[model samples]
Target: DVKVTQSSRYLVKRTGEKVFLECVQDMDHENMFWYRQDPGLGLRLIYFSYDVKMKEKGDIPEGYSVSREKKERFSLILESASTNQTSMYLCASSSSGTGGSATNEKLFFGSGTQLSVL
Candidate 1:
């Protein structure tokens, strides 16, 4: 079974402070993603790394950054936390696909991290 572990289940911080959310996946998947879920915006991808040391920006990359130093680890960094940044953050991992029809593979997700900035 694939397991995605998020370091924090809940976090609270005041505005202007820096925040770091960590995620680790046991499976040696080639793709890892970070997304933030909001009521109206839905799940917006922040960043994703297809391979170690290779990262691509997603739709909402502003105010966020990601690091994939190892195959099993990916981290999301918030330079300066703000009230508007408060949301439910999700980390997911999935393989590039084996057979020819692997493009539709499902992504395994972590429980989630709810961040609140005052």
Candidate 2:
């Protein structure tokens, strides 16, 4: 099975500390994304990388950034944590091609990281 593993399942942070969350995929997918999910706001993308050392800012990139130095790994950075940033952080990976399995072509998600900023 294609698996995406997140660096954390839960986190507690102070108001202004920097935070780092890592994600890795075993399938070597070409697309990696970071999103924050809120109760009613749904998922908002923070950043995405299609290749090593390359990144594209999604709709909501403010106060957050990303890095992908290797094909199988991606990292999200919260420049300064705040209470508003407290939410469920999700990492997703999508293969470059649809291939044979339509269901598997969609994004595969990690368990997620819940961040609580105090």
TM-score for every candidate vs. truth?
Answer: 0.95, 0.93
Instruction: Tell me the TM-score of model 2.
Output: 0.93
* lDDT tens digits, residue span 1-118, model 1: 9999999999999999989999999988999999999998889999999999999999999999888889999999999998999999999999988777766468999999999999
Best by lDDT: 1
Against the correct fold, how does model 1 do in TM-score?
A: 0.95
Cα error, residue 20 of model 1, in Å, equals 0.5
In terms of lDDT, the poorest run of 10 residues in model 1 is 97-106
Best candidate, TM-score: 1
Pairs clashing within candidate 1? none
For model 2, the stretches where C-alpha displacement exceeds 4 angstroms are 98-104
